[model samples]
Target: MDCQGQTIEVTEGQSCRDVLSQAASGKTLKKSVACTCGNRLVDLSAPVPRDCSRLEPVLADSEQGLEVLRHSAAHIMAEAVKTLFPRAKVTIGPAIDNGFYYDFDFERSFTPHDLEAIEKQMAESIAADKPFQRKIMSRDEARKFFSQQNETYKLELLDELDEDEVSLYTHNGFTDLCRGPHVPSTGFIQAFKLTSVAGAYWRGDENRPMLQRIYGTAFADRKALKSYLAHLEEAKKRDHRRLGPQLDLFSFSDEVGPGMPIFHPNGALVRTILEDFETKEHLRRGYQLVRGPQLLRRDLWEKSGHYQNYGHNMYFSEIDEQVYGLKPMNCVAHMLIYKSALRSYRDLPIRYFELGTVHRHEKSGVLHGLLRVRQFTQDDAHIICRPEQLQDEITGIITFVQDVMNIFGFAFELELSTRPEKSIGSDQDWDRATTALHQALDSMGLPYAINAGDGAFYGPKIDVKLKDALDRTWQCATIQCDFTLPHRFDLSYIGSDGEKHRPVMVHRTILGAIERFMGVLIEHYAGALPTWLSPVQAILVTVTEAQNDFARQCASELHQAGIRVQTDLRNEKLGFKVREAQLAKIPYILVIGDREVQDRGVNVRFRNKEQAGTKSLSEAIEMINEDCQEPFKRGGMRYSFSN
Candidate 1:
C-alpha cells in the first residue's frame, strides 16, 4: 500500500494505525483522528480493506478532520451522559458547522450545574483513554440488543435501516449506533467544552416528544478553544435581540404575537431609507415598480403550484365562500400581470419589482427575532424573458447583488440549489433550469457550491450568503430560474417568425427580506450605522440659553440642507448632551456656544471620537454630503437616501 506518498508492504490484516505508526511523515499519528484509504475515511484502529491501494493521513486541523474530532467528542459526551443519568435515553448526535450536539430524553431540562457534572464525567473518561471498538451486527440482533436497554430511539432507527448489517461503536461500556470513523480512542479528545443547552423536538417534529439538547465545541488545542470562546463572548455582545430595543429601533410584544415586530419611529425611518434606496437602484437597472395584494384566490395559488407544494406553511381564509391564501411569494401576481398583456419578442424580457409583504406559518420553535419571522417584506422581482435570454438575465441579477452588497461592504458566497424530491415540472425542465443557472454563474467567473435538493419547488436557484463582522454567514440574496411557472400560466410572446413561443420566468431578491437584512445590518455594524443610513444623522447641542437661538438657526440651516438633524436645547450640561448623542450612535454632534455665536461656526465631534476643528455650516454640510457619497465609490449610481 502507498502511505504518505511512499509505498510500503502491508500484511493482509494489518490495521490502519499500524501503517500510520511506521509511515515517514511530518504529521504524527497522535495528531490524526482518522485516515483515508483511497476515497473512504477509516478509523486508525480499523483494519485496511483487502483491495486498498493507497492511504493518506487526515490531519486534526483541517475542516473535515475537525468534524471527525467533533463527532468523537459527541460520542464521548454521550457516554458521560449515560453514565451519570442512566435513565436518560440518547438519540442521534452529529457534528454541525460550529460544533456538536446530542439530544437526550429526560424528565427535566438540563441545567448549567448538570452540564458541569457531565463535563467532569467526560474528563474522567478522556483521561482513562479507553479504546473505541467497532463491530458490525445484523439488523435483528441490533434491534434486540437496544430493546434490552430500553433504547427505543435506537430501535426505531434500526427499523428504518435497509441494510442487512449496521455498525456500532463502543467505548468505556457505552455504545451508539453510527456510521462513523471515530478517533483512535477517548484520549484523542484533547480540547473540548460543553457550551449551552436548549430544548429541541425529537426529529424536529413538533408533535413528537421534546428532548434536551446539549451543545459543545472542540478544537485541536486548548489555545484554539480559548480563542473561540472569546469570539462567542463577543457575539453575545452584538446579538441583535439585545441591541435592537436598547437602540430604540424595533421591539416585540408577547401580547401582540410571536414572530411579529413593532418598528419604532427610528426603525421605521431606517426601513424607509433602505426601501427607498432599493427602489431607486432597481429603477436605475431597468426594472419597473409594481404592487400586489396581500391575499390571492386559492385557485390561483393551486394553478401556480404553491398551494400544492407549500400549503402546510401557508395561511388561508374564506371571504364570502371563497378561499384566499395570504401571499407567501410575489411571483404569482407578477405572472398574472404578464398574462394580462400580449407580448412580442421586442418585449421579451420584462422585469417587475415590488417590496411585497408575505406571510408564512413558521413553527413556534424556529421563530427568531427578525431573521426568521412570519410576516416580512421581500425586495422581490420577477423577470420574464425568452429562453435564449435566460443566461444574460441571471448574470444581470448577479451583478445587481454584487453592487448592493459592495455598497454595504459585505463579502458573500454563492451556492447552486437543485430540484427536490417533491418538486414541480418534468425532469427535463428541471435540468434545463439548473443548467441555465449553472452556466450563468460559470460565465461570470463566479464560483459556487452545490446545495442539492434545497431549491424552490418550481425550479433551481443561486443563493448568496453574506459574511458579516463576526465572520458568520447569513442568507440574503437569491436568483431562481423557473421554467415551470410560465408554462403553467401559459405566458407567451410573438416571435419574429410569427409563432407563439413560451416565456421563461426568473424570481429573485437582492436582500431576502427588509427585517432580516436590518437585523443582520444592525449586528454587522454593532448598531453604529453609517452616517447616511443612521436614522438620526446628527444632533445640535447648545452650551447655554444664550446660544439657543444660534443653535436653532444652525439646525434649521442643516435641516434645510437635507440633513437628518435635530436640536438638543434641554436644561443640561453640554457634556451631558454630547454624551447622550454618542450613546445614541449619532454620527455627528455639533456644539454651539458663545464663541460659536460670535464666529458663526460649530464644533464637530464624531461618534468614533474624531474631533474635526470648527467648520462653517457650509463646510459641515459638505462633510456630511461627502460621507453619504462614500458608499457609491464602488461604481454605483449616486443617490443619497439621507435626503
Candidate 2:
C-alpha cells in the first residue's frame, strides 16, 4: 500500500484508521473524515484490504468531508428534536447542495421557537462529544427494534428496503437508520445553524401525509459558516420576489393565477428591450424569425415523444373532442417548419429563432416567484443541419451564449447532461448526441462537468449556468442536439446526390426563459441593471417648480434620443427627489436647478452617488447614448440604432 509516496505493508483486516495513524506518526489523525481506498470512499473505521493500492485523506475542510460533516450534523439535529419533542418521528435526512434537511412526522407544526430550542439541545449534544458508532443488523432485527420503539416511520422505511442487512449509526443513546460516512464524533461538527422549517409532503407526493422539514447548513469552522451566512443575507436583500414589487417591475396576483406574473409598465419596458435585443442579435447571426401556435394536436406531441416522456409535466385539454397540449417546447413546431418545403444541401444549416411562450403543469407547492412559473417565454431557437455540421453549430451556439452572457456581465459554467430515465430515444442516437456535445466542448478546450441522467427527453444537452453577483448559479442557457426528432417527424433535405436525407436538429436557447432570466438579472445586479437594460435609465429632476419647464425640455430631448427618461417636477425638496431617484436605481439623475437653467447644462449624479460636473445638453445625451449602447455592439458589432 502507498500512503503519500511512502510504501507500507498492511496486515489482514487492518482498518483504514490503523494504517493512517501509523503513516502520520505523531500527527493527529482525527481530522480525517474518511480515506479513499482506490476509487471507493470508505470510513476511517472500515476494514482495509491487503491489496488496497493507495490511501488518500479526506480532510474536514475538503468537499467530501463537508458532506460527511453536514450529514452528521443532520443526525445530531434529529437527535436534538427527538429529545425535545419526544414524539416526533424521524424519516429520511440527506445532505443536499449547500445544506441538509430532515423530514419528521409530528403531531403539530414546528414553530420558530421550537427551532431555537432544538438548536440549543444540539449544542449540548455537541458539547458532550459522543462518538458515533455504526452497527449492522438483519432487516428483520431492525424492523423489530423500530417497531418496539413505536417508530412507525422507521418501520415503513425498513419494509421498503430490499437489502437483507442495514446499517444504523448511534450516538448519545440516539440511533437512526442510515448508510453513513459520518464524522468521527458529535463534537466534530464545528459550526452549524438551523435555517428554517417548512411543510413537505412525504417523498414529495401530495397525497401522502404532510411532514415538517427542518433545514440547516454546516461547515468546517465558524469562519466558513459566517461567510455563508453573510452571503445568505446578501441573497435575501437581492431576492427578486422582494425587489420585483419594490421596484414596481412585476407582480403576481390571485386573480391572474398563481404562477402567472403580470408585468407593469416598468417591467414591460425591460421585457420588450430584452425581446428586441434577442431579435436583432439572432438576425445578425443569420437566424430567421419564426412564430408558432400556443397549443398543438396531442398526436403531434406523441409522435415527438413529449407525450410519453413529458406528459406528467404537461397541461392537456380536450377541444372539439380532440386532445391538445399546450406547447412545453418549440422544437415540434420548428420541425414542422422544416417539413413545410423541400430543402437542399445549400440550405442545410437553417436556424429558426422565436420568442415562444410555453406552459407547464408545475405543482403549486413547487412554484416560485419567477424562477419556477407556469407560463414563460423562451428565446428559443432551432438549427437544422447535416450530420457533419453538428459540431460547428454546437460550437457557434456556445459562442453565442458566451457573447450574450458577456453583455450581461455574467460568469458562467457549462455542464453536459446525459439521458434521463424517463426519456425516449434510441441508445445509438443518445450516444451519438452525447458524444457530439462532448466533442464540441473538447474542441473549444472548455471544461464541463457531466450531469448524469438529467437531459431533455429527446436528446442530451449542454446546460449553461450563470454565476450571479453573490456567486449563486442559475440555469439560463442550453444547447441540445436531437437526432430523434427529425427522424420522428420525417424531416428531410436533398443532398448533392439528389437523395432524401434526414436533417440533424439542434435545439438551443441563449436566454432560457424571459421571466426566469429577468428574475436572475434582478438579483444579479441587485435591481441596478446597466444603463441599457434599466427600465428607467435616467430621471430628470428640478430643484423647484421654477425649473420644471427646463426639466421638461431636457426630458423631451433625452426621450427623442432614445433614452428612457422620466421627469420628477413635483414641488418637493431637491434632496427628497434625489433620494427617490436613487431608490429607484436610475443610472443617472439629471438635476435641473436654477444654475442648470441659466447654463443650459445638467448636473449628473450617478446611482452610486458619484458626481459628474455640469455638461451641455448635447454632451450629456451623447454620453448617455454611448453608455446605453448594448455591450455586443459596443464591442464592435455593427447594428442599426432605433428607439
| Top-scoring candidate (lDDT) | 1
Q: In candidate 2, what are the lDDT values of residues 1-643, reduced to their tens digit?
A: 8986778788888888888887864444767877788877777888886668998777888888888889999999999999999989999899888889999999999999999999999999999999989999999999988988788989989989999999999999999999987888899987999999988888888888899999999998899999999988899999999999999999999998889999999999899988988899899899999999999999999999999888988999999999999999998899898889999999979999999999998887688899999999999999999999999999999998888888888999999999999887799999999999999999999989999999998899999999998888999999999999989999999999999988889999999999999999999999998888888988998988999888888889888888889999898899999999998999999998889999999998898899898989898888787786656573455323455
For model 1, residues 1-643, the per-residue Cα lDDT tens digits are 8998778888988988888777845456768888898889999888888889998888888787899999999999999999989999999899998789999999878889999999999999999999888999999999989999999999989988999999999999999999998988898888999999988898889999999999999998899999999989988888889889988999999998999999998999999999999999899999999999999999999999999999999999999999999999999999989889899999978999999999999987798999999999999999999999999999999999999898899999999999999999999899999999999999999889999999999999999999999999999899999999999999999999999999899999999999999999998998889888999988999989988999989988998888999899998988898988988889999998888889898998998878997889899899988998898788646857645
C-alpha lDDT of candidate 1 relative to the true structure: 0.92
TM-score of every model versus the real structure: 0.95, 0.95
Per-prediction CA RMSD (Å): 2.0, 2.0
Our tally of clashes for model 2 stands at: 0
